[model samples]
Target chain A: MSHSLQHNRRLFLGALGAGLFTTRGAFAEQLLASPALTEGPFYPDQLPLDRDNDLIIINDSLTPAVGEITHLTGKILDASGKPLKDALVEIWQCDANAVYLHTADSGPKKDQQDKNFQGYGAFTTGSTGEYRFRTIKPVPYPGRPSPHIHVKVSQKGRELVTTQLFIRDHAGNLQDGVFLGLRDILDRELVVSDFEPMKNSKMGELACEWDVVIGRTPDEREFERS
Target chain B: MRRVLALSAAVAVCLPLLNSALRAQPPGAPPQGGRGAAAPNAESFLQRLMQYDANGDGSLTLDEVKDRRLHALLNRADANEDGVVTKAELTALHQKESAAIGRQPAGFPPPGAQQPPGAGRGGPPGAQPGPGAGPGPQRRGGRAGQILPEFVQDELELSPEQREQVAELQKEVDAQLEKILTPEQRALLNQPRPGGPGGRQRPPGAGPGRPNGEIREN
Candidate 1:
């Protein structure tokens, strides 16, 4: 009887340990691979009032952001280099005033926040698995770990991956553990951004091209999950 | 025994015809603005169309055709936006999408932007081409780049402003990238190097994927 009881206890402990580890692993598996970043506290709690193609502007309000506007474009290819058609990419960021769309964003007051920044935008990949977004260049925000762009990729109502794109030249990268962990070239392959001269204006245009590689193998599942 | 043999012969004779008659192919190419991949036998476009088929009907409706989810994709293959997608169109769209899906996040364009005069292409999804002349497969040699040379300079051509616009966008990202990433990461970038457990080398001949399709590095 003692032996049988011991066996049952061992089984119970194993099951309990498995559950605990699973929970921890799910929430904290480390974000690497895909250059896309997290939405952070900037994702709008509610949709913007004036939802245009331009994320740089919140509504049709007269003034746009004082900072440079960027045209972020790129294609999503699989490891095999094939394009994943019909994919959806969502991105969010802080406005020029260092304010995000989230409730926690710091500013003197909520309404006082710069309403010109669109804060978030979505683009659907066409047959070429290519997508584009219009927004302002991400500026430094107070107390944030680094200047980063949070992104999410999805297809057929299923979330494929959500990660952050660290600014390659940011001084904070060395300090950020996540960025350091992705030191390898493949880990940082998509971490790219380029600046272009403005058209008929003083401020130049900012360009960003990120090639995201979604995990197709079974091993890729762990990284893709939130 | 004789009757059973006769029935077996009848079943055998009908099977091949049924298989050929109801193939699960993509609707052929759309009428306008179609990329070369969607021109004929690609598989990706059919997958998107299948998603819109809510009631399992063999055809598409205005609602299915106009689904905003499919706007960018369907537009690539639809050409004229007449709302009906065919198998030939589906093939090209699929091939195009598959390549795009694999492309690096740099701006890539659609294929078939240009064609050698009368060089032959795929059909609209389900619509058969001229007698004995179906849309040929993999005519681009392989997925060269996202933007076809023809389209990049033609009807779907990128205006000088657009090109400048894209270049400026790249510049902005480059600034941010320089400011954000470590010198080590940046060094490895734009050049191939040793990798980690994740595997570094992007295998060659990715079997018709993106990173090509006219995403020129200039």
Candidate 2:
């Protein structure tokens, strides 16, 4: 498909998705809470110059990072399905070569690291609880089989949940111990995102939508305990 | 035609680079056995299989497939669908992986030579810091050295001295964050931490912590 056509389709879908969240607020209580997963080690020892949501390009670089460009977007919600505004959402993952932004790892493997790739990025959710990141599809690392992106959510400057998101039906996921350890099928499903090809793009860009549902708000948890 | 030639040329270059690196391993030096030590490009995958084939029969059977993941892929590795996997089949599998992953694997540095220090899950155990280790505490129990600080630093693009100053302001940051919490929330935050749940994770080759204990980036 033509690149412009696909781009338009994506924008329309993005708007539609946001609209659904707005209309579904009354039914939000029925949504499943996103399962929590370990934050994992390579969260980036050093941050890149561009902390924006677009990770494909670093601060005005013409050469884009190598990898299948993935449009990652999601919403942050509470157990009641209320969108959490002003929440900080951060994500970090390895570049196409499976190297992270951390100095210890990237320092030695600097030759292999993609200098153009912004290894880490963050975005704040607005009233819609929506966040988006243009990054590469996560690849399997040496020890870990499942390709994943580490995600952290914070509100009011306090961490809510630290988790990781996985690719749905990645062949390696079956053998991944961390993925298999999740005994609850629902929780397992929550962490995986569908990486579908954009409608008409020659570049094979992928679009992923993953909503994060925290088990409880900090205030709610504290109030319940009292 | 040009792409094929280029690809073949790249493969030709990689074979020798990997072989010489394999040969350089001192006779019987303990293999860098940890999962993080070996980079899994096409060449290394084949090299690793040979290392497992202790008898040098040039063929590997199920018994030789010690790594569970390789064992799982073993069935598919048999291109002819034969029970036994021959070097020919392994080569085909390698070719397939190279094509699918879109990586040439020719440019990677030699295995043992380019490995980052403190390679395994965090630097040698214990909180004691290693040379060049960052001022942060060593990674332990899956909670040490974090990405959040780095995220904050990068988002603000703070200078090195400013970063140090920010680190010094940890007490203030904590106080500000604490103000947002209710009394009950404060108590919960102060409670003794529980041992982290198991399910090891890392960024490609990055283990839990570095020797310098800088920030842990898992």
Candidate 3:
């Protein structure tokens, strides 16, 4: 029932946002800012040699980054808040084992879990800001107190926003400075539905859905294009 | 000799129309108003294999597969708000992704498997008389990063002279983006260009080109 209620709220909010965006202008560049990818401690040491953006990177010979396999999903909208069908959305994350592709991740091998985790994923927005991912659920580790995911939004080549996601109701949320520092609302925004047991089992069988709200449109000058 | 002349006349008459039809194909794939493809939801697969796999050794564990954290992530991912991810949802997602800072896997086609209406999609030139005439839906696809040619032009209200100043600022931003990514990511984006008039087929090694070309050409 928790999933059902959260699902309904998502539907309701999307409808409201879309209803508002539609009555205003037919071509108002989407109102929501570019979706953001949450920055994590682990990105990638160097870009993958193959660099095809495959998520699972445990085996150099094998493709697709391997991780917990979390399925991510959500929507996009305009200011008047209509679902911006066909808008673009992108995402990237630390591969499993907490290593990122950023310079900050240049530490020794002992600190890393999955040396092969490419730590990133991307998907375009459908007719709505709605997007989905077949990925591993974020895992928590030492140093960084919370588990989160990074995201980015776009239309064509222009980038809209970059942001991150936090584990809802995680005890670490309070301890993690970054997670705690977000605006009260944005922090609260992370609380999604709880992990209900899929009819199969409770441990591995889990479903999580997160919705991100950006404050601008795809063509805005304020949003960074890089 | 008379028969040869007749056959030559037939070829001369048919070739021009064929050429024109061929030229019309490039723009026809992407529908103007709206065109789309739909995919079956992977939910049932989750139910059948992952969720129902009581042993939970190799298959997706029902718990690991579903979580509130992931529920929220998925809520954000399911852009269409149709409850379940339809095939159109997958295509919509594919179209929005930029192939630069991050990208989707090559083999991971959208649910509908609407082949990219290009040389990649198995529909090479001369294979179809016109774009939309093929079996798949007319897909209005475009490249990412379709910005005005000049970086300085990005900021409005600046005089031509100030444009150069804006370019400098833009350079700073690019440099910053470069800094943010690892050496490898930068190399992927700045991969050396290929030599040719048709850079579109830049071998996968040509580096991540700005996918925005769809906007300019369309």
Q: Provide a comma-separated list of chain B TM-scores, one per candidate.
A: 0.25, 0.29, 0.22
Compared with the real two-chain complex, what DockQ does model 1 have? 0.01
Model 3 chain A weakest lDDT span, ten residues long: A217-226
Candidate 2 per-residue C-alpha lDDT over B44-106 given as tens digits, one digit per residue, 9 for 90 to 100:
345435545545676777776543324545666887777788766765655443333222111
Instruction: Tell me the spans in candidate 1 whose CA falls farther than 4 Å from its real position.
Output: A1-39, A106-112, A181-185, A196-203, A218-226, B1-218
- Cα lDDT tens digits, model 1, B1-218, are 99998988655543332322222110010112222212122323243245345445544444554223234344456655677665455445554443332232221112322111211111112111122121122122122221222122222223333444544555566677779878887766644322321123336533433222322221
TM-score of 1: 0.40
Query: Candidate 2 at residue A81, lDDT?
Result: 62
lDDT of 3: 0.38
Estimate, for each residue in A1-226, the C-alpha lDDT of model 3 and write its tens digit: 6964664455344433333332212322322232232333344445445433235543365654445555566665543355555556555554455444555542432343354555555566666568776555554332233456666555555444455566666544433334423312212344333433344554354455665544322211111111
lDDT of 2 by residue, A2-103 (tens): 864664454344323322332212222234445455555567777777899999898888998877799999888764567899999999987777578988
Lowest lDDT 10-residue stretch of candidate 1 chain A: A217-226
DockQ of 3: 0.01
Instruction: Indicate the docking level reached by candidate 1.
Output: incorrect
In model 2, what is the error at residue B90, expressed in angstroms? Answer: 40
Pick by lDDT: 2 or 3, better one: 2
CA error at residue B102 for candidate 2, angstroms: 32
| Candidate 1 local lDDT, residue B205 | 38
lDDT of 3 at B53: 26
